[model samples]
Target: MDAVVKKIIMEVKKGDQQAFAELVDLYKDKVYQISYRMLGNVHEAQDVSQEAFLRAYTNLDSYDMNRKFSTWLFRIATNLSIDRIRKKKPDFHLDDPVGGTEDLNYYSQIAADEELPEDKVVQYEMQEWIQNEISELPPKYRSAIILKYLEDLSLKEIGEILNLPVATVKTRIHRGREALRKRLRHS
Candidate 1:
């Protein structure tokens, strides 16, 4: 942890509410990004991110000072995301026609400045498709893949977040990649 972050965490532990807000400011985007990647819904991601911080605040006393704070917080968020995934049945699709319009897709309705070049449009569509496929993955593999690739965390860091051994993280990533490749090949 950075020294400044360490000091802020210490202050938070000492019951300084402003210190906790500072921590939220520092990590809210990251938490939301991870949640968005995992959940693939803007509203659900926001809700999950908020819930993660709330949970962290309530359980702050249980946090081990020796462990990386981000890792601990991420673990909480990841577990909550997994639980949400298991509870909800997916009723939405990215490619679904927007609000019952037969011709317009959800993506086509997204406002863009100027006109995107053909290559950029193709690349953007491909990225969106990949993200959709990722959201379909089992929670275990999805968490590993998102943490490793999207978040660019080291294997050990991912392992810590997911509460798994490094080798297990590696296996999950490998399997997740293989599944994605198979999906691409079929598509």
Candidate 2:
């Protein structure tokens, strides 16, 4: 953690609104990114991110000083996104019978970029395809991948965020990545 962030957290613990606001400004993008990746919709991600911050702020007294504030905030965001996912009930069992009907505008933009070489374009497509496959993974694996890769959190941090053992976090990340790799290779 940076000294500034540490200071802000300390101040926040003492009920400083300005310090809390600063902390939120520092972490909002990261929270939003995690939410966006998990929820797959900008609007829901925004709502979840906002709700996470609000919940964190309201429960600031419960925050531990020993941990990184970003980690704490991300945990809240992840839980909120998962709750939203449960509420929506996405079907993980079905394959796309109508090939390529889903939103490919984001994928298409990357593929259309002239700056990328042919090999790079292929890699991008594969990565995008893998991301789509990951969405079909069970919730636990999906959360593991989002935290490990998209949020760049360490296994210990991920374990802390998800309230799981470090070994469990490692297993989930490995299994999730392997599943994604298999799906991409076969596709």
Candidate 3:
């Protein structure tokens, strides 16, 4: 952890409400994105995000200062998302897939690189299709894939976040990739 975050954590530990709120503000987007991607629902994501923060605050004293607080927060968020998935077994609602799939904006850049406009459109569609496929993966695999590829975390970091071994994380990523490839291939 950086000095500023450490100072904030110390203040939070001392019962500084402002410090806690600052912590939430700093990590809210990342927490929301992880939950949204993991649960594939906006409402659930918001609930999970809020719950994760509450849990973090409640257990802040037990948090090891030696660890990265962001990872710990993500661990809480991902666990809540996984629990929601298990308890709800939410049906694959094609009509209400995960929100925020619209961040993909590569059409112009690719168009300038000799890729025709038609091809760019197809690419965008394929990307959205792939995102949907990812959201459909089993929770473990989905978390691994998202943390690794989307969030750009390393295998060790992903393993820490998911409480899985590195080799297992690798296998999950491989399986997730193959599953996505198979889905696209069939489509």
Candidate 4:
């Protein structure tokens, strides 16, 4: 909604590839973050981020100037992530080995960074656990929760992004939080 972004969007609509690139540079990290949070895989996040930009470019003319561009862009990315989740088939490998009976030698073979303080290690582990639990959520709740908490968007913004009513968005967030609380409590 800033003047600078509006100008860039105008230039992009006028076929300025550099302007589009600038827009990508501005939002790539945010898009990737959303994708990564939703998919929990670096490669898939990267792919989704790229695809979001590509889709935005292709659909540029359809973008409504009256609305916030970020909302529209995020909606596209979230929908694509949801589609990817729905399409994912369980992966199985017939030849894959089962549980490891090997010794602790493999742990030493892998290189690790400098050790963190105890507090930092515990905090990092807790964050990872929470993220894993979030990943287990249904896509609707996951999208609502991530957009609200991780992206720190407003309830109305989240409703717009998910194409739901504000009341529905609030309900989703409440349900999602309750689900997360249950998961955390169980663990």
Candidate 5:
């Protein structure tokens, strides 16, 4: 962490609410994105993201300065998301047939510029299918896969973020990929 961030953390620890709020501002979107990918629910993602920040603020004393703050924050978010997933009955299954979807306007220009309409639709479908399969992974495996692939974190970094052995993280990612492959083959 930079000196300015270290100063912010210190200020928060000293009961400066604004400093804590600033920290939340910096990390909230990332936390929410991780939660959304892990849990596959918008409302729960919002809740988990808010709770993660709260926990981080409350548990500031336990934070080890020797570690990267981003890793620590992500750890908390992922744990919260995992716990949430474990507690809920899953709302959807990968085996279920998907319905048609709305176009993502952001992809519109790029897809139009680069490919024909049919190609864009197929591309979008494939992307959505992959996401669905990933969402169906076991919570532990799902978090590991998302951290490794979607967020593009190194295996070692993922292990650190999740407080798992490097070997364990590797295994989870491998299993998650195999699961996705099997699902795609069936589809």
Candidate 6:
């Protein structure tokens, strides 16, 4: 974490509303992306993301500064999303399969590097297809895949965020990618 972020978190822990707002602004998109990937619905993801931040704010006293703040926030967001998923009677319909638009923008930079226009189009299509396939994965696998790839978090960081062992996190990422590859191949 940056010195400024550490200072802000310390101040927020001490009840500084301005510092809390700054932290919120810094992390809101990350929280939203994780929630959105897990929930797969824009409205629900937004609500869950907001709730995660509120929960984090209320539980600031319990936060351990030794760990990354982003990981802690993501853990809250992931748990809230899981809770919401569990509460739904029909899980698939509730999930809504919203492919990640944020990821498309992130990959657009890479797509631009393709020399030929046809290759660029193919790259874009492949990315979209992969995103759709990933969204269809079971929630556990989906979360692991998103955190490892889209968020660019290390396996250890993912383990901390998801409260899993490092080996388990690596397993999930591997199996999830394999499943996605299988789905894409058969499609």
lDDT of each: 0.88, 0.81, 0.85, 0.86, 0.83, 0.82
What TM-score number comes out for model 5? 0.78
Q: List the residue pairs that clash in candidate 3.
A: none
- Which residue pairs collide in model 1, if any? none
List TM-score per model, in order: 0.84, 0.75, 0.79, 0.84, 0.78, 0.77
Clashes (N, CA, C under 3 Å) per candidate: 0, 0, 0, 0, 0, 0
Better of 1 and 3 by lDDT: 1
| lDDT (Cα, tens digit) per residue for candidate 2, span 1-187 | 5788888877877777887888788989999988877877667889999999999999887988777878788899989989999998554322324356664343443344357788987997776566567677777899999888888888999998999999999899889888887776755
The TM-score, computed over Cα atoms with residue i paired to residue i, of candidate 4 is 0.84
Residue 18 in model 2: lDDT:
81
Report the C-alpha lDDT of model 6 over 1-187, residue by residue, as the tens digit.
5677789988987778788989989999889988888776678889999999999989988988877889899999988988887785664442243455433442343344436788877996786566567668988888899898889998888999889999999889889989888876766
Model 6 segments more than 4 A misplaced: 91-132
**Model 1 per-residue lDDT at 154:** 95
Which numbered prediction scores highest in lDDT against the true structure? 1
Candidate 2 vs. true structure, TM-score: 0.75
Q: Choose 3 or 4, whichever is better by TM-score.
A: 4
Can you list the residue pairs that collide in candidate 5?
Answer: none
Displacement of residue 51 (Cα, Å) in model 5 is: 0.4
Candidate 5 has an lDDT of: 0.83
The per-prediction CA RMSD against the true structure, in angstroms, equals: 2.6, 5.3, 7.5, 3.9, 6.1, 7.9
- Model 1, runs deviating above 4 Å: 94-120, 185-187
For candidate 4, which ten residues in a row score worst on lDDT? 90-99
Q: Between candidates 2 and 5, name the one with more favorable TM-score.
A: 5
**Model 3 lDDT per residue over 1-187, tens place:** 3778889999999888878988998899989989888876678889999999999999998899999998899999899989998898646554443456654443322346554599877997776676678787888889998898878888998999999899999999999988778777866
The lDDT of model 6 is 0.82
